[model samples]
Target: MTETTAEIVLFDGFDELDAIGPYEVLENAAQAGADLEVDLVTLDETDLVTASHDLRVEPQGTLGQPDILLVPGGGWTSANEGVRAVVEDGVLPDKVDACYTEGSTVASVCTGAMVLAEADLLEGRPAATHQVAVEDLEAHAANVVDERVVDDGDVLTAGGVTSGLDLALWLVEREFGADVASEVSEEMAYERGEVFG
Candidate 1:
């Protein structure tokens, strides 16, 4: 069987760790024989998005029906406002719903949960985000789950930035096997932490 690929969505001012952590975990999972492919994508095919710390990431492609869509978040300011606008304009909602209907997994990290909520994807759903953004997540009617990672069936969420790694590892365990997850964690020296179901 062909391995499924996951795409991490990047936007201007997105938190670097929010995207990089999960990327690292998934990459490690592939090395551990999980057969997972990962890519960094953006709304535009060629434009480069700048991270919160001024790091630039040029996407390989536009988000095109990815098997998994991971959204990352950062501070809400002038830089992020543009990205938020794109998300709120129904782009994310439409894409996320389409992916979900196609049996693709959806997830978010840190304030990325806020973007999911804004897209109305988290309405009345239990999810996790950065502790600092819990209020924002709640504003969209999502039950704030306090944990490094929250697995609610098809939708998963990770708390804060570094939790993306945990979320990715958990997904590997779910889609492949616990042994693969453990091996990946061992390779990265990442201790498997508690996850909220």
Candidate 2:
């Protein structure tokens, strides 16, 4: 069986659910025998990062080129540290662009779409993001959509916090099989929402 590696990018002020929801779904898929390796990674040298809700997470390692790169949104609405800070710093976006160029399937959860926008990856692409950041995404020239998840070929995006689950389940189904995705959702007792491609 071919092994697929997935990295969920974690940063300071990232929403807990945005990262953890997909992490759990992928972990369950791995448990169900999907030939997948899932990891929580950071872009900086600091090891322990705090979430928006004050939840602390120790990332496995620095971001690397993975088969799937998952970006989670956090402080996009506010002028605080989170998506906005990452965008301004430009390091994360540059890394994301490099990974994408290297054939990583880029995905975003919630306002994480803003980071993709910064990388110039979502422009003219049908994507979804947190409702509050929809206009901002549009300003970046993205064709925003209303759905739990939007799949535009290699670039996938999901709306709001809970939609990360749907995005992850979709990835499991797309990469592995429907049976695996169904088994993962059933294992998590999660009912997936609609996915617009």
Q: Tell me, by lDDT, which candidate is best.
A: 2
Q: How close is candidate 2 to the true structure, as a TM-score?
A: 0.98
Worst 10 residues of 2 by lDDT: 76-85
Kindly report which residue pairs in candidate 1 clash with one another. none
Residue 88 lDDT (model 2): 87
Per-prediction count of colliding residue pairs? 0, 0
Residue pairs of candidate 2 with colliding backbone atoms: none
Instruction: Report the C-alpha lDDT of model 2 over 1-197, residue by residue, as the tens digit.
Output: 67999999998999999999999999999999899999999986676999999999988998998999999999987775899889988999999999999999999999999999999999999999999998899999999999889999899999999999999999999999999999999989999898898
State each model's CA lDDT, in order: 0.81, 0.94
Candidate with the greatest TM-score versus the true structure? 2
Cα misplacement distance, residue 103 of candidate 1 (Å): 2.5
Which residue runs does candidate 1 get wrong by more than 4 Å? 77-89
